[model samples]
Target: MSKDAPPHISGTPESSAKARARKLRMPPLRRRRLEFDDVNVVDKAMMKKAVGGTVVGNTMEWFDVGVYGYLAVTMGAVFLSDADKDAQLLFSLGVFAATFIARPLGGVVFGRLGDRIGRQKTLAITLIMMAASTFIIGLLPSYDTIGIWAPILLVLMKLLQGFSTGGEYAGATTFVSEYASDKRRGFLASILDLGSYMGFALGAAVVSVMQLLLSESDMVGWGWRIPFLIAGPLGAFAIYFRLKIEESPAFQATLDAQEASAKAGDETESLGTMGIFRAYWRPIVLAMVLVAAVNSVGYALTSYMPSYLTDSKGYDPVHGTLLTIPVLVVMALCIPLAGKLSDRIGRRPVLWIGAGSTIVLAVPAFMLIGQGPVATTLLGLLLLAVPVTFYVGNLAATLPSLFQTSSRYGAMGISYNVATAVFGGTAPLIMQGLIALTDNDMSPAYWLMFTSVAGAIAVIFMKESAQRPMPGSMPSVDTEAEAYELVAGQDENPNLDVDSLPFDTLGSQQGTQSDADPAPAGTADHR
Candidate 1:
């Protein structure tokens, strides 16, 4: 036999057919997975990884927000040069609001992707978009050089930044919450806001330093660009870490459940966006109202406060920015602690206390700041900051827990963004209008007081979400209406039997099994 001879083949037709059949019997290869594919979704090993990536990314996003708000005066002078100083500031703040206008659309689009694809992926995309737009703003020509193109381009960039931001916070909160144990969900989620305030503080600090060191002309000319440009490297660093993390285990578990359902011939209707709206509308409205309070108070304290101090209260702008630094630091520290408190006690009590205090103190706090010899002004801000942190810290955990997991991202995104756009985004503009109209330095205080009423309504109606099983993991979606009644200490029927109610009434009739029927043991980790 020759050494290079082919394998001996039977010449018969039967044998040839048999060989072809054998070839066909070989099994197909399995799809390859990435290295971290098998890692636990809530892996203890990845806790620090998840926290760091989320905080850094959130910090960068909010840092841009901080820069825009803090540098509004300088940005206005540069980009809206044709207007008087007052008009320029108004125009600049108007550009800032432009970002909020696009936020709801961003929320819906990004929320869909987050729900459909994965949380980590949506977050990464948002971070990249936000960072790029922010960096580009740094390179824009002043109105003096580019004429009408300056404000026009500024508005467009603000739109992009707003769009990207629409998805960022909701996605980050969803990612962090899914990885966290329900017992600690409040504390963990609060860190997202902690990073946010830190970024705002950092932006203010940077601008304040520049204001102190640079000439007024220099700050208006080019110094403002440095803060915007810093976003580039910061975003890159966040992206690198974000890419290394595993997908959220809760999301992956949902996928596993869906696939298993498909194989078992259980054809459940997937609720599209409209379906989500129909089923989750009540909770969505409540969440939106709650966010309105948060943003209004937050922006008033952080963004509009600087301008109010300088323009209305007669404090130097530089000194005002510096004075607000301690208030921010106090908020940062209190945020995590408040989160922990929510975890131990409950979310509603903490929220109610915060909202209630704001109603009482808004006018007094504003008056103190207006009449200040610097020390009293700082004290007044500190009083307001404490209440603000209570709401901000618990928001990440409470908002997402408002609805079922399947539609959580969408509901939170749309509701939160809409509230933010209308209230938080407009805070500075509204304050300006109020001050101009009333000729009162404390006009902003009255606005804050009015907004606090919404916060009170939200807390009174919102159900306690602490340590509850997440929505989809259970066999049924939670009814927010029912929860509200239960937590508000209202009994719909003391005499009604629990078993008398229809099984499907708990969750909407969209693709969910009866609550009475137990799900497969392996499908979810209820704890």
Candidate 2:
């Protein structure tokens, strides 16, 4: 009759024997006590280094992206001198999309490596590959010199950039998310994008300055390579910062746990590529849809807009590149604010604002850009930047929460890059091809609207992770006092679901005997 006792049965002898057999066969309900050692105390200095290193490398990665995007037209001319205007442009955009072709492979390889070796080591390798490839692009000979080899070489370099980049963002997000305290994760993770757009704005600024200072012929002749060449030094600076930082505490703890389990003769199943797909497919699919939506808008704003402005809106390349710089700078500055707001309100609400704004503003934003005045174009860009600020600022923090710490990086790499390859990287080509086919300048707007709708729907299914510990990790806090507070209050804390922690699941798998008996089945929360 006690609340904690097992259910009583009244039955015939045969039925009673069957019931007892069933009870004996059932697995025990696993549980553990919350303890101080389970809480991760945030080291402030290490947290700062982690954030700085990750953000700087992210900036460099996006800087390469910005350079390639802003220079698409010029590169087309340089690489395909015999092609007509439209052919040249199309070829260039196709090459940009081609970069993403290699990203999924990069994601798989580096994702697995990061999970196996360490996030820090894998990230360093990716940065080196990306920087080296970008620098190689600047040194490539023109189409006039290399005949067919020019475009071929260009495509190869872009693919390399894409390959390296596949690992960069996912690893960076995983790293920073693991380093941050639960309450400030949103704000801290948002700093990655602040660096991202700042890198973008810096690239735009560099290209614009080059365009302004040089004649059109001079730019096509050699000036365009300047931006790509800049990656060498920028990458070195980023790598320096990156190498100084240590691995994230959550990942380290997971590694340690795995080692200890191994030493005890408990073999945990490794979630390889197919295993990850099997175990976390729903979250993987959900993450893909969300990524598709966010990156569609993102690629539209960063990669396609410059070409659109130049080709359709009748702005010269100078003004087209120049117009986006201010908008990017303003957007970059506001990213952290949006991130902080997510921390205060919740991630879903902030994401909803992004998705809703995209749906509402896409048409008007395009219309303003279509008007062709300088002021109208800038206004339109700012309108588009609104949703982007909300979406990208929270994405790094949000996506990593979907999977457990054991497989977060691998799952993210697979989901994010696959979506980006399918939808994000190809946005410019798709938008441009749509317009060419239908002659609708608003085609890109409709695409943005569609993706945002999908994104909004995805948000509905997402678990709210704001101010909570990441899955498969302990409650992370900034101070020892906070750690004590968390441990004491954990039973009543809405965010701290101690029953659902990995220890229970892992312990159950070990079939390890324990002195304490399991809780009764009906009383346990399975997940």
Candidate 3:
């Protein structure tokens, strides 16, 4: 039979007539049609639940981190000794940076679990641990009450938060990405970061309110603890949402495939860090660079802004915190829009907009910020926020697209965490040190410029991934071309069940003619 021929009409003429009669008795297929449609083959309602579950954990983690950044000076006073104010602030931020130190470790541990077991379970564990740690920080005694142990406890709690978050941010992004259709992945995945920004914005709002309402002494004595304490309740709420959501069907399909292989006594393949690293080194390097650039700017904008305004621009800490609110709100709004735009135009274009715009505007924006008027500062900050939003908004969909399902969680977590630890987590401390050394108020701009350039270079190298189908199994080294070819090869083999399709289809270089092949029974789209 020709390849284009209709599927074999196997029934004999008499059986066909009987089947026609049965069809007339059955309900029409059109009656079951649903209005929602997207690339991922999931319904709209399920996708929303997935996004909600993923976003809550992200919000809680970032919220705690933002609270710490907003109250760094107060934390310094409470945790550090009766030393120089600058020294105390430095010590406090140093401890803040300590969290990044634990992230890479968390990435390895949690990423492994996510890849090996499942994304949902790993996220649940990390969220609980991170929230618990943040709550503990609020309960610790100050240096005046507990001596050096207070600072030591603070350091420990921060480290725990960092470690837990190591798994969280990346894991949440991966979870949402897997659930989203390729066409809508950018918009859906962007919600993960929107949750994060919202978390940070809410944290900043709380701190700003406290600073505005309370006396200086009251803020110093007790107001600093409120935000940290709030993490507990927020965490409980996040956990509830996470539990209500279902596992990634993509991951579950992988498991089903593995079980079938075992039952048939066929050898089932497993992915490891070394194997994944060897296959995906190019994307890994590019992802690290991309993440580093975006994160440096992100931390600079959110975590470092309050300190930068108060210390360098001579604004009140409360006013500095207040300024961040508008910036984060702009980011939160921009994230989903950027995601949808990327879906329309493509991920690479959005990334280019982010990197190129940041490179052009970073220096000028910082100059305006240093000018110190509310109007100029807001304008400068808004200029910077625009590019960063484009970058971050598209990141979840873009980054996870680089790897196959088997290796995606681990690859994303490790590379992203490494870059974040090196750049994003340290932006504020670096900015503080640079200003002190050079007395150049524009030092932060220089760092932003450097990272933005790196991001641009990475963007220039990234493969366009809009509407690209995810690999059903582990893809080969050339993920952009190989994944589609793999799917095509699977279509040519009639005996290979959908779950039995090899994760990596070697030696096939055919065009995507096989894309027309229908998915095997009980299988969803896999990439």
Candidate 4:
């Protein structure tokens, strides 16, 4: 045989075929070049308005949640006056869990609507529904007045609130994330949760004051209605802000691209519920796991802690509710700091800190709470807050990054609410049940530890998205100069992976460039 001739492989037919296959394989797709014009220049003023609007709505939603949570015992007594104390407490918590039952359905309906209509409009609708339902709950007739119908009406209103709330957080996060510049996304998005816990703290404070001032009969007879009634004005205020805001720029861009694609006769696949599931089930599942972990700790602190303190730890209703107020306020204040830290280091590292801290602090936090002094209880709550700060702070930024701009709202609605329904909303009841079943007060801690372990594992699989462009969108920067700088340093910027970006989805731009295209002047192709 001539020297140039191919030599025969000394292996079975399968090995020979495999060798041939390797030789014939296509080369990897080349990284796309980014031009200065390709970078999106964020409107700072508009971004701030968008963030404010979204945050206010989030705050209102959580305020309603906080009112319900802090008033769990009182609500039970008012609605189930015939039941034993334990039964009434259980009944109230059961009603609270019922709110989450409607979340998944709300998530699907509003999520798709947000994706279809616009984030701003859908958000306004959800806020109206949430506020109205909460206000109506305040006007609901008590068991004494209406007999069985009172609890039924109460549950119906809570379910309505749950339905609206299903859309609130997911839409808020998506709205802020899309509006924010990539560099400041973490810190900006974190502000939503800052509003969230602050709302919770406000609710606790209001309830605590009412408890101090009102007689027990007064609270049960009339005072409990005040907080829920307050939702009417707050919801109106949030709705006004939401209505004033425009659709998110990223989502608008996606819509524009879709329109352009249709005009040019390009086929664009619609990502409905099943389509989203089929296309992005992996990330959806991963996000659910992460949601489950963080919310377990979050709900345990915010929702369950008051009950745990009052019922199990032997604190009065007033002290139990008041004890968490300071801790929540402090933790809420620190959430943005953790978000900023995630921006500097990376999402995964900060998430690792959150997960690891939950594992380490869960048992100790419960132990300190069990000690029964104000200082020890505060310290325990603070320990629980540590992991919550790291975890919840970054979620608004991290979860949205998992999916593309086109389906992010829908995907988030499904993933977040489902996990919340199962783990988050049920956390209070579950902990209560766990303690009863095991006859061990530490059962809640063990549950938290288990969830954190799962969270840690999920973190390993999550893509590091800090300081990176969201999928299906252009690189977003705060200013024209920043856009130019990003393009100039594209090759050297580790976080900006041009190859991974879905440039094909950028509509008309897809046909304008190819692998052979050279980098724009002043930019180097180092990949």
Candidate 5:
């Protein structure tokens, strides 16, 4: 298969027909078609429920976290002293960063555990953790009530939630994608992402409503805890749905294979973190780079902006939240569009466009933050959402495509969480620190630009995994020659190569550079 022509459609009619006829000779697992035209063999029935199940589970998890962000002002009182607003915010940001730190560790522990045991059990555990922590947070006493211990307790609780999320998303996304029919993977993945965003959106709407109903004094005093408490119910409800769901067929098949080995039930064979760490470190690094901007810009542009408007721009928090509704709406609208676009063209070009636009627009976005009219801010939101959609949509589908079936859950979880923690998780704090240090929003712009550049660098190095057959690890390459060789390696057809393919004949660059393969001393485009 060439890079340009869809791998799903690559083989000649005669070859495809002969191959279909020869299906009887293949193993049951191998007999299933992995391309768009094939039926979804894994979880054919339960897989029908995978996307909805993932969304419900993710919605519950993000709802818990999003409530804190939406109620930042209220939660600040519980964690920081009134003596210093910026200091309090900084402290709260640290608390926020603590969760990211925990996320990767959780991913490692959970990924290894899930691989050792099953995705079903790990997801069940994560949902329970999320629900318990959220409920515990609602019942927590504030600083005035318990002094320093109250804040310390809050930090500990955040660690639990962070750990749960680290495992949950990667597990859920991998499960859903692995089980889902390839034809609709992007669409289904995008729908799952809605839960992540909607959780925040719902939190925003809830806080917005509370602000309208409650006096500012009341909200600051005790009203803020209401939103955090709400997450408990949502989490508990989601757990019921999550538990009812079955295990993914792919993971089950792997388990069956591993069990067939002489070392059956030997946990180490199933659960070695070192094996994963040493083998697929590139994807982990690439994931961190890829999601940092995705998560950070998510924090800086949307989450941090509300507080920014209230404090620096002198806008009413209520008015600012209301005005920013369009950004969310635009994001929701664009997310699915971007996902569909990637399905048609490719994930790499979409990701490249996302990185490139972020490079060019990072400064302008912040500069426009306080500029001319409400209309200008609206324009900025449109610009931000559209390019950002490209990244988010691609990420929704692309990251999972990088891993092999054997370790997809664990690899996806750890890499995604660690990247998010450093870049996304710490974004608000780091950007705010720069602003405080420099006395300008411009500093945050530079901070955002730094992360965006990392994402672009990541995109430059990433091989196009879209339209490629799954159950295979992403091949090593940044250019056409390596891509050609990679295709030749996996191709069922013995005679296929770059020069003879329709895609190459069509003169498509196919997102692969024209450079030849590197020598032993040369650089490889790892994460």
Candidate 6:
């Protein structure tokens, strides 16, 4: 079959079905998916496959991301000078953040490309970009051989990686969630974070091994690039596997419908940045908030933790890795569980748990960890690790759901990039300064907690898509209220112990404080 040929996706609703034949010349999607006899609802099996693909793809991308940050300490000297080590490291991190800044642009570019061409194609190209750029970073000339251009080239490569990463997560999550059966989405979507943690674990292991193999001089001189070189083959390997996964059923259905209805007099708005901005700015803003919350915490732990421990807590770098291994492992294990629970309960409550706890725990955990002995630090980290998992695992599906698929890429890509660039990208730098300003007595945990508070507040108003009408099924009959309404009343559902979930998370305009409180433990939403 041709690469673009539709694979059999098991269960997509017949969103385009017409009541009778001889429909007036309608939009292409209305005619194709709606007119077809084979269309059906997306079920759990297809949802599982969608999630599987995303996990594999994200795993590859994140593996390299984690490896780079972990190894950068040993390798920092290759591209920088002794006189300016601290400044150079900061510049390197700046380069890292620079990549994040480009994500939104990539989102708009790749997202529109995906909407116009196909999600699978766009995704494949992005994976290629991420792997290829990371690999090339391994090959770049160092400061000793070249000069300023080396760092410039390094920044360029980072930009490429950032741009591609922008669309990868949102595209994969949306692709998976949109195809999932209604109740299955949160669980399956959480699989994305599982893949992320898998990458994190592997990256940690890879760098730890590299640290053992090479002396500091050799590692800084040449050995540092080898991991990046591995990414080239790794990217190719991931693409090979990704090729086997099915295209998003929703995207595929749209493609077929769009092609069928393209003959003449179609009213579908072409997905352009301007078009996306005009229609989806609000949801786009929400998606950005979602990415920033988890991403800020993510960078703090994965990227900043090594330094945080060594600089602030008086731990050795290699030992810090040993300490970090458990935290990363725990986070990996918990993310999927949180995601599955979200599927069973709902995204809103999962998000509430994640954001609320992070806000509350950030300060206390940091303060205690900073003051602790090795065991205490580990215990404090154990506590910190819990809430981070909740946020990362659940945001998998929640961020993408904020925008319509028609413009999801643009919305999520840009919003995530822009928000992270402003907040998450600078979180460590700013937090470090805040601690220094406070005479190094205060914990960044509190700063992280405070930093994440805005995001938690932002999430309070986030839209829940749990009961969103399945794609390929009827367009919402009550479009206006359906679009804004958070919940379909469950007063009649026998299983719903509504009182157990105190806040009006059912799309009610409840304040952030009430919306975020976890239900007494053992309830569906809280559990």
Considering summed lDDT, which 10 consecutive residues are worst modelled in model 3? Answer: 31-40
Cα lDDT tens digits, model 5, 457-485, are 88777776554434432222223443454
lDDT of 6 by residue, 391-499 (tens): 8777867776565444555556667667777776666676666666787645567666765676778777765655443322222211233223223434453433334
lDDT of 2: 0.87
Where does the lowest 10-residue lDDT sum fall in candidate 6? 510-519
Candidate 4 Cα deviation (angstroms), residue 498: 1.8
Instruction: Report the Cα RMSD per candidate.
Output: 14.3, 6.1, 11.3, 7.4, 12.1, 13.4
As a TM-score, model 1 comes out at 0.82
Q: lDDT by residue for model 3 over 1-527, one digit each (tens)?
A: 34454433544565567778888999765411111111124545767798988888888889999999999888898887577789888998898899999998899889889988899999999999999999999999989898999999999999999999999987888888777765577998999899899999999999999999998788879888898999889999999998887777556655555566578787456656666666667788999999989998888899998888887788888998999899899889889999999989989899989988888899989988988789999999898898889999999998887766766788788899999999988889998999999999888888888988889988888877776555442222123343344346644633224443332322112211011112222232323
Question: Candidates' lDDT values, in order?
Answer: 0.77, 0.87, 0.79, 0.88, 0.68, 0.66
Better of 4 and 5 by TM-score: 4
lDDT of 1 at 146: 81
How far does residue 103 in candidate 3 sit from its true spot (Å)? 0.5
Which residue pairs clash within candidate 1?
A: none
Error of 2 at 474 (Å): 0.9
Better candidate by TM-score, 2 or 3: 2
Model 1 lDDT tens row, 74-133: 888999887898898889889888889999989999998898788888899999999999
Error of 4 at 192 (Å): 0.3
Superposition TM-score, candidate 5 onto the true structure = 0.80
Candidate 3: which stretches are off by over 4 Å?
Answer: 1-40, 473-527
Name model 5 segments beyond 4 Å from true. 1-45, 263-268, 473-527
Tens digits of lDDT, candidate 4, 1-527? 34444545345566688788887896876767888767778777888899898889899999999999999999999999999999999999999999999999999999999988989999999999999999999999999999999999999999999999999999999999888888888999999999999999999999999999998899999999999999989888988888889888778877777677789997466677877776677888999999999999999999999999999989999999999999999999999999999999988999999999999999999999999999999999999999999999899999988877777789889999999999999999999999999999999999999999999999898878899887666678887888778889988998888765556656323211111111222231221
lDDT per residue (tens digit) for residues 1-527 in model 2: 34444434444565568789999999997568777766778889999999999999999999999899999899899999999999999999999999999999899889888988889999999999999999999999999998999999999999999999999888999989989998999999999999999999999999999999999999999999999999999999999999999988877776766777789997576678877777777778888998998999998999999999998988999999999999999999999999999988999999999999999999999999999789998999999999999999899999988877777788889999999999989999999999999999999899999999999999998888998888766678888898789879988898788766655543322211111111222221112
Better of 3 and 4 by lDDT: 4
